[model samples]
Target: MDFSGAIFEGGAYFLKAKFEGGAYFLEAKFEGWAYFLEAKFEGDVNFSGAIFEGDVNFSGAIFETRGMFAHVEKIEEEVKFSGAILNRVFFEDTDLTKIRFYGTAIENAYLAGANFGNKRFIEEREAIDEERNLLQHITKALKKPGLKSILKSMFVFFAFPDNSYRKIKTKCKPISEAFRRAEDVYRNVKLSLQNEGDYETAGEFYYKEMLMRRKRTLYEIKNLKYWLFSHIYSKLCGYGEKPLRVILAAFFVILFFGTFYWLTGTVTGEGITDSSFDYYYFSVVTFTTLGFGDIHPVSFTGKLATMLEALTGAFMMALFVLVFGRKMLR
Candidate 1:
């Protein structure tokens, strides 16, 4: 189905939809929340100049030909192409603030026109270009030398370019062995741009997706000058922690509940300002797995809170056990 010259200006899409043949969204834009979740694309899909304001979920899609998202122009929210299969992809000239390529595979990709949307990345262009030149020179030098030429082609094809590096490594063992020494450079390029707030962030994510495929991890080091506020906020806001962090998270969540209690109690002077004490006490009891019925809640919201605390306690304890098991056993 040719959707070229058509505009998909809606917020909702049918779940698990299937589109065969080449579907073109060349210059078409998705202006709001959209979903192609579990949708399958069975041919070449072009999304050049398309804009995604919300989440993109092509979870079980198949791009038999190639998928081009080059010059995406704008992607305001997170992009998830997880669990999808692609033959090739182009993402040059995109504004991707946050991207995740978890569990996705691109077999053979060309990223020639791609740009990471920043100046620091622009600065690295010369160094990358120099590496490209060196690759070309080597490719020609070992051209006539039998096995050496095969090794040389591997060096040029899998070494410098950002896209097909890992795919080539997994498919071509001979080439993979020849450039084993360059693994650090490959890892560093991915690690450098792993958690950038600027354009470097997306580049790192994209590069990692290409290099490691499903086994990729995004590296994030809090920038002291920039992320000071955010780091403090996450710590204060329950994120990516277990065991004691779980306990701390419960305390903060209940703190928010206590704050709500304090503000609302002032509205009716007889209302419970005492819920503050109850919040901490409940969290503590919940953390310790106590099932006492003495200080029981009366309101329906309070009952819901009790259930939530109980569930949170169970989750935290499980997390504690799982995470600590890995550390202690290892």
Candidate 2:
């Protein structure tokens, strides 16, 4: 059943169809809804370089052998496979950013290098800059009011420089909708990866999911406190998935308090000393609540700084242990 480079302008239904041999849909374009509900594929199936612009479904379908869908460029909506029997399906090097998986169970699935539209802060900033530049170009071209200028603006709008970093298509829909869908997909994929015993990948997806959620809350929901908490959680320990971040946070806290103690000046048996190392040593003692009593703060501000440093240090130590233990236990 060859459908190489075929174009489906409308609905493509193959309900309960049985393909006894290999099925090929290489470079096919699905411009509308595609359905293969309860279909049976007895041999290998390929859909490399396909473009799905609408809804797609393979619910209850059975793939007796391997199936592949690599290098899919654009998928505008969900490509559901709930209740499908995917024996060995491969989606490597595919962009699944807009797709959603619901109630699906995957076995021997290969999803290496798949894009899920999970952008970090740096990537998001780059995207924003790109958008700003594009808008500026478009505005300048439109001000001329000529066919050539209009064409150039259109070209610039559509002919975005293709790169690995461009995962989400910002023009497809609203940013909030994209974020919501991304959050949902990340959660589902995280759960799927956890079920497959890939904790490290699952943790990465979990971080992405939280990032999307945080953005949604901040921009869409306009929840200031919630966003602040989420931001702090990400910075402190990456939602408990990165123990190294906790260690760094603790080190920074100690350094900050040490500098504060040095600037404010403390007391020793030999009176006040301007040495930075002595203040740092006293800072460490205060942070750990050692309380040797050989060194004390003379001014009220210095005493307050020591008290706050002790409290902060204790909290940071506990947080580090909690984060590290969570990672180790998992």
Candidate 3:
């Protein structure tokens, strides 16, 4: 039954209608309310590029096989799938602002590239809260408790792919409010996965969760002391990933202080004249706090530089040791 390019000027109903073969609704336009309540599709179904100008309901409907509902251009009002059994449904590259999946069993559903636009996020949150409240009422309608619970959990887990995580991260990369929303969703998903005992997948989500938290700290929270500390920690040790960053920082510090010592001309020694090599060597010696007694600072600037460099060197060396130990242990 192909309704491709068909236009419905008023409300349309397919209530309790059963399609035993292939069904197509490509490019169909629904100008008023669209109903598919309890409709059953026994074979493949396609609804690509459909435009729903008014509310559409598929409550209690069943898709027994694969279904395509991608690239929907617009849905001016709510499109609900509550209590619908959607099997291997594809909803990619669609604006999902008005879509709701409460109480839906979406097994192996793919939602890649779907845009849950920010405008509907508040409504979506409210819907989720309402659904949570209504769960008690809906639980009484369930026939098989264990199987439904397992299938629903699996559906929730597979509805969003790992690449979807990257999409959320990229979309929320710049704005703090968007990132907060992304983080909230990410943390919820991670917790759900953990609760399901899927530790491996949960670990990946946990990493993303921490990364979002770090980004939120850097961009949204605006805590100065923590920001500064985290910034320095990342640069010096790459958050404990790249030890070479510490080495580079140490080299830069040595060069800067060495130049300062040479310019001040404050070091006096028996053989160390106004030579660049002598100044650099003396700088390294002072930084390491190895006072050989042959070369000493003759001025206040040199002494101050020596003290500062020594403290910096001590801190850097300790940090390197700690980071290196962590890496080796890991």
- The lDDT per prediction is 0.48, 0.68, 0.67
lDDT by residue (tens digit), candidate 1, 1-330: 766556566675747877777778887767666676777777778988877777767766677777888778777887776666666666544543355454566555444333332211101111222123223322232232231212211112221213333343343333333333233334433343332222233233233233322111111222344345434433432222223565576566656644543444321223224457754554466455695544555566666665776786677567657645643442
Instruction: Mark the regions of model 3 whose C-alpha exceeds 4 Å error after superposition.
Output: 1-174, 181-211
Inter-residue clash pairs, candidate 3: none
Q: On residues 21-126, what C-alpha lDDT tens digit does candidate 3 reach at each position?
A: 9999999999999999999999998989999999999988999998899998789998888778888887767776678766676776555555654322221112
Estimate the overall C-alpha local distance difference test score of candidate 1: 0.48
Task: Compute the lDDT of residue 271 as modeled in candidate 3.
Answer: 53
Error of 1 at 116 (Å): 4.3
Which lDDT tens digits does candidate 2 get at residues 1-330? 899999999999999999999999999999999999989999999988999988999988888898888788778887877567776777767775555444444555555555545422112212322222222332332233221212211111111122333565343334555466556655765665576566776687687778878876755656889999999999999988888998888778888888887765654545346678877788888888898887888878887888888898888889889988877877
Q: State candidate 3's TM-score.
A: 0.48
lDDT order of candidates, top first: 2, 3, 1
Number of clashes found in candidate 3:
0
Model 2: residue 108 alpha-carbon error in angstroms:
15
